[model samples]
Target chain A: MALRLTGYDEVMAQDLIQSTWITAVRRLESFEWKSTLKTWLIGILINVNREQIHKEQKKKETEQVREDTMISKSGTVSGYDIEQGLIQLPIGYRRVIILHDIEGYQHKEIGAILGIEEGTSKSQLFQARKALRNWLTDNSNEE
Target chain B: MKSKMNHEELTPEERAAFDELSNFKLPPASLEARVINELKNQGLIEKQKTMNIYLKWTASVAASVLIFFAGSYWGKQSIENSDIDPNLAYMLILHEDESFRPGDPMAMFEEYGNWMQDIIDRGIKITGHELDNEAVMVKASSETHFGEEATERTSGYFIVEAESREEALEIARKNPHVKYGGTIELKPYVVR
Candidate 1:
């Protein structure tokens, strides 16, 4: 999950998981069991990933532009292509699509995890799916 | 060109593609080690023992002397009396720290195989398995802690047949783990 969220960057994904574990252990007493442990850990991971992105905002912007170009040239729609398409998605769209479609989390749960409004989660999912579909269909037409 | 489809529902191909992403991928094993190390550094997990080398040497020598005398007395008694059960089971709990010399993994396996074969050749039944790094400590307070809780982790264990407690200690002393600077605690299983 962290891997997909971090656009398959292994080093960043590993760092996120490590940070999440440390944070979870530190704040274990505060965990009221409102959600499952896995859900709680993922919430920490999302926050950690967001913090890291803020820290590396300039580098990420450059990488995102490069990834967008690669996605445009990528031909055909397959599982691997879909994953590439996800990597090229805007961070917010990627998070919503991954949480909703890939992880099967509902708008309510997604809102809780991402700290967004339930309606915002629903709208983001619609926009994310639409964007992903357009990218996939465009690639398919090219092939 | 795009197909007319509801933006809320993913196309079947897109759903199938998303399904592929849902399959869990295992993180690198080294990442677990790194996390545990960082936890230890932060004082969240117990650190390994930092005993003086001389103190460790002294303790090792004292334990050897005690084992030698106990083994001699028991060996003499067992030979004199045939009533002693010759096949008592004892569990050898192997504890390993940073001092443990697990050189090449293949060589370590070969060494273990030879050790087990030696016991089998002596007509002793033996079984054991090496433990993984992951551990969860569940407490009475309904709290669970993950990772190592102590300095030395239980690397593995072996249950072998011996004549008595002293004989079990002697067998444990000869284990490859002892030669590799690891500790083995001999425990007799209670028969009900």
Candidate 2:
């Protein structure tokens, strides 16, 4: 609808028509065929978009790491940290304690399997673990 | 997962910023439907990949046709009215005699304007530029030049369009400079 006229009648609705034509023409002209004999230009643009997406993915991965390592006391420990911490624990001690306390097993199995009183087996193990934890912290402070 | 922001433990800057936030307030209920309708009317905005090549091609062809006809019309008009030929040139060489002074433009100014305008109107003269009268001649190792003392330099020149050598001379004869005891040197100007 945009007509490019060399000359026009000034007496008509010239200003209005000319302004409308200019606006429409400009918008239409924006859809230019930017093709070239060298196809590498378009290839580079695609590569740039790909690089941007890769960068965004890397950023998201970093955000995930931050989420896992965030310092909080609201019982949000990462599984990786738990695995590493459990490795430092004595094999039988933590195994028995985890089965009884963490896994909510009966003390009869703690006694039969690990040789201790059925009722006292749970509480005694709990107290011993608390004492060990305090001793570790104290030792750390001394160091 | 990391915990969301706990406002109770906010830093002073964060707490102050949070305190300034307004309570939930709804927009005017009527505006929501209007916005939805507007969105529906426009639909999705998208970029076009290609232009209508057929339309542009047609326009180009039409432009070529218009140019051809328009050029022929003007070409014919100039040939009939002005007797212009590409190979021809009109040279008007100015000559002043003993009675002519260099600085009396008032006597010839009006007549020169009308004279030059007539040539332009007839489409005979495309353009002309006036030159300063300074001529140099090398005599042995020294050079003799036109200055205040050496006043024998040709005055000025004009180029006009003509059909033949005789017609060019006729143009030179009618020049305003010739009326005041001045002669014109007509010559053929070959343009490469």
What TM-score does chain B get in every candidate?
Answer: 0.47, 0.48
Expressed as tens digits, the lDDT of each residue in B80-133 for candidate 2 is 233335478666777665765432232243345456545545657433323345
Name the regions of candidate 1 deviating beyond 4 angstroms: A58-76, A141-143, B1-3, B47-192
- Report the CA-based lDDT of candidate 1 relative to the real structure: 0.61
Best by DockQ: 1
Top-TM-score candidate index? 1
Candidate 2 TM-score restricted to chain A: 0.32
Q: TM-score, each model?
A: 0.53, 0.30
Q: Which segments of model 2 are wrong by more than 4 Å? A: A1-143, B1-86, B101-107, B139-142
